[model samples]
Target: MSSSSEEIRLAAGTAEVGVQPGNGCRLGSLTVDGVELLRQGERYGSFPMVPWCGRTRDGRFRNGGTLHQLPVNSPPHAIHGTARDAAWKTARQSPTEAVFTYDLTDPWPYPGRVTQVVELTEDALTLRMAIETYGDSFPAQAGWHPWFNRHLAGGDGGQDDSGVQLSFTPAWQEQRGDDHLPTGTRVAPTPAPWDDCFGMPGGVDVTLTWPGRLELNVASREEWVVVYDEPADAVCVEPQTGPPNGLNTLPRLVTPLEPLETSTTWTWRRL
Candidate 1:
């Protein structure tokens, strides 16, 4: 359960990003001018999601004619895939960029490889991920789950929707059922407490601004992103290849020749 604390730090202007290669290739911290932007801890920062983005119904999925049952990490559902907590091998590294890779084995049913590349610039950070199977084609998804602090400058450390403002024009929302899985019905965007998925047919683009502080623009070419802001201390704007339970509902098959790739970028500036 312990990962190498060794960090690969990158800095550009007032922005600093820390990546832990051994710890699931997780981003430990993202600070802008000494102000921490990501929540700190096991469930914080940002982690890559591969094979699947969110959750699977009852931890079970029927691919082709075989029924695959994943371990129920979240009680009734299998969440976030196995990559988030898995240790990734550092394939390459530089002063401001790194590449991490993980091979998918048992339980997953498909033999595949997942690769994540992170690049840092003076004003932005870009993340790219892809999955490719060695054998037959299989369903998969890719995304990043970043838990951003509500108060960028370490205000009270309380979990309230204060200071930070979230804005996005979603084309539609996937109505969530009691199981926290999408009900296959798409509705219009509503208010807060949105642990739901939204469709950005135009592309995944969202804005987070802490008035008088800094403004962050999260843009991705992916068409789907989940915005979870019901928490007190932080908010999550997840950009994924598909919605939760998509493995069974909307599977994106990846073959040895065709890999599923997606990218997301976070650009920031002082406001």
Candidate 2:
């Protein structure tokens, strides 16, 4: 185990994870049996989605009768959230786990504290996030955006498979409009190459298999997940508390007494 201001490394059994607290508290790497499961680089890796998940319509939301506006980082919408652009502080740490926290400020309107926990074991990695209000209550969401490598490439990573295959049976896929926001419809599960959200009221259970190389399952208690497999080199199985633009469609309040929390876990096995 090694710790620094920028990142923390945790290892247990055959797994190792590198967490970057400075860069939006994202996981820099996940290497198991020498194969790097996560896509490397700053924009890649697994990052905790807090305060809100996915996008917020036109970067605006309402609390009571007051309407709040957020910076439109993704143009017409505010993708992800403010928490991922701010640095986080390490609250606690160990050889196989760590806890990080950051206070919500500016652009976000309401004040709140977000905490994230990352734990690693031989075969599984668990991630947890919570948003606690510091003052007035506000609508929010939480989740994770993990960029997984589409193909195994290093250590014993030589493989001939084209890419990892996603396997899941989502009850219904949120109808996605041309503008990329859910059109307020829940239709049957559509075809893959999806960059859309799906409903798993039973909880999110999706698997990624790389032929005879590896197999990983991304699971969460939350019922929503955004599967983005459009990229050529990376695939994202984002398990979130709500759907895209959920703040307007499905608001979850974070009051002083009632905090908003969510979690997702990744369990793997060598194939």
Candidate 3:
């Protein structure tokens, strides 16, 4: 039952992944065949978004007849979810797989348990999450935010690819408003450096290619993916159940009978 002090490392085939249950059950590293594919460092890496994903507009949301206020961490809105900010307990672990769990508490206005499973294969990494409620039904969302390296080792191709080029065909892009939240308008796909959300009704399928190096494919059953490539060193492809401010706009429920769940997988090939 050791927590934070222990960092779980999973290795398989040509890939190695580091999981930090101490720091929000996030994937701290991803290295494939001596090539680092994730942005290194503490602030980066891949983290889970549970109970709710993306922003909560002004840090406020109404559940049933009651309204709850959450701390504004993203300035002007409550971004991500509480799970990413809290440490998780190691529920189980193996060589190439691990399970972590945490309970939902105050400020979230719900009673639930969040469980995340990380499975790494020789050529792929799969992540799954579920939120089971202990009390009244409440709105919730699930997702994963991975900050991929804009430039992998020897993947230098200048500005175009950061050595990494993004390729995806989303059904439509969720038009982002000045507030950085989806305006509920679906428009055609736009260009890069996007802080925008896109819809993929047939599921999310995005690829990042590093010329002559590697190609990573991010796929999920979820319909929404947020592409944020504004940072100079990294690009984020987030797969979630809903868009930002979805707590008020989308509001998927987690009940005693049905839990909220979602998963995303990243498969790669050396080219």
Best TM-score among the predictions, by candidate number: 2
Candidate 3 residue runs with Cα over 4 Å from true position:
1-5, 155-162
Which scores greater on lDDT, model 2 or model 3?
2
Q: What would the per-residue lDDT of candidate 3 be over residues 1-271, giving only the tens digit for each residue? A: 3466468999998799999888888888999986777897776799998777788899999988899999998999998899877889998899999999999987688889999999999999999999999989999899999999888866353444446789999999998889999989999998887999999999999999888778999999999999998998889999999998988999998889999989999999988
Q: Total clashing residue pairs per candidate?
A: 3, 0, 1
Tens digits of per-residue lDDT, candidate 2, 50-145, equal 778887888998888998898999889899998777788998999999999989989789888999999999999999999999898899999999
Q: Against the correct fold, how does model 3 do in TM-score? A: 0.95
TM-score of each: 0.95, 0.96, 0.95
- Alpha carbon lDDT of each predicted model: 0.87, 0.89, 0.88
lDDT of 1 at 126: 97
Clashing pairs in 3: 161-164
lDDT of candidate 2? 0.89
RMSD of 3: 2.2
- For residues 30-86, could you state the per-residue lDDT of candidate 1 as single tens digits? 988788899999667999987798988999987799888999999899999988777
Q: Give the TM-score of candidate 2.
A: 0.96
Rank the candidate models, highest lDDT first: 2, 3, 1
